[model samples]
Target: MDRSNAFVLVGAVGAGKSSLFNVLFDKEEAALKTQAVVFETGGMDTPGEFFSHPRLYNALIQTVSDVGTIVYVHDGTDRTCRLPPGMLRVYGGKRVVGAITKIDMPECDPDFAERLLRENGVNDAIFRVSSRVRETVGPLKRFLFGELSDGPHACGDVERKKA
Candidate 1:
């Protein structure tokens, strides 16, 4: 696996990050299952157990700095889908591909999620997704790896990928 070209998942708890991770990487149990929290999907050969915590920003930073792209997951169902303050502080101007997970849920609001990103200064690309369904994960992956493929410093590389 190339650590230089990996994808990092970030979001609040119960945001379906793990579920999206599993769907994207084609893993059934990429993250530990719980009543509330869900992990993000990935191509990691060794899938680990999921643990909830408030320090996800640190994890996002470590993962983003090491990997090529960051998949910042958010719970679209939640009215407050804004990026965490710590995350914004660390990955503020970076190339983060936003993903609104749990689109199948009743409360997932695409407009609110987009508004949250704008309010938080996240001007980069964003994607709405439902990890429970396979098809929704494809666009997010393509956006992160296809259009946002260039290095963070490269210009004209932040355009959203076309489906």
Candidate 2:
């Protein structure tokens, strides 16, 4: 596996990173607790612990070291951001995008999630999607698969659909 050409998912616990991973990879099984890093076809799924715990920062850094891109998953219904300050700076050379998940949930606030993601350091394309909704995930999948063209929108300004 030439991980340098792949992408990796990172976020706090319950941010739906695993669910997005399963959806992106076309896995039919339920998402399980990601106790450790799991490598799949196009990307890698990282354990949230590696991101939320300061002590595990090294692990997270190492886990994504080889990947060319980083997808930071944020729960749309949550108001908090667990991404440590200057954490993403470590990967200055990697393409860091954002994904606001759970937009299908009634309580989700994608606008706030997008604001939080921007405040944290996701200056690239930010995708808002629901794992259960294939249509919503299309743009992201297309972008990741090198099929999405940079249409009228700039990188960080992609609007998410409201449920």
Candidate 3:
């Protein structure tokens, strides 16, 4: 389990999964391919189709073999979460982080995304960051690297699950 890139991310298409991944790690730029799985020294990025199709979920479940954390992304501009309830818990025992991408969009409401994620059993912290802006992603980076002190974030910092 390499901590450097031990995070694996999942989200529907257009949720900015690749943008966030690129910003988080200074990796070589590449054109985004449809339904392609991107693996790095530290993390893995899956295609949106994986989640939409139940059959592909096995691949995501199997991916847990290498990652220490799982992050589910939400597009703040989207009208709905799209994920089935309790989807975050599917990767049990792995730390899960929820992120709302495109938060800076004019009509984007990160709060709504956070609520949707929470209702879906994302007991840990839910973050709001605009992948388009590098600065907005720093908080998420800190949380991902376990750099923040543990506490309930009124503004969404890292938190422990309630039993």
Instruction: Identify the leading candidate in terms of TM-score.
Output: 2
State the lDDT at 122 in candidate 2.
92
Winning candidate number (lDDT): 2
Q: How well is each residue in 18-80 modelled by candidate 2, as lDDT tens digits?
A: 999888888878899999899887788989898778999999988888888899999988999
lDDT of 1 by residue, 1-163 (tens): 4555556665655677667776776777655643332333332211111223444444445545555565666677677754646554564445566777666666566768768866765567777777666676676666655643543321111223233
Candidate 1 whole-model C-alpha lDDT, 0 to 1? 0.57
Ranking by lDDT: 2, 3, 1
User: What ranges in model 2 sit over 4 Å off?
Assistant: 152-163
The predicted structure with the larger TM-score, 1 or 3, is 3
Look at candidate 1 and tell me the lDDT of residue 30: 52
Worst 10 residues of 2 by lDDT: 152-161
Error of 2 at 138 (Å): 1.3
Worst 10 residues of 3 by lDDT: 154-163
Candidate 3 lDDT tens digits, 93-160: 67877888877677776777788787776667777776556667777777776677786432332222
- Quick one: ranking by TM-score, best first? 2, 3, 1
TM per model?
A: 0.67, 0.89, 0.81
Between which residue pairs do clashes occur in model 2? none
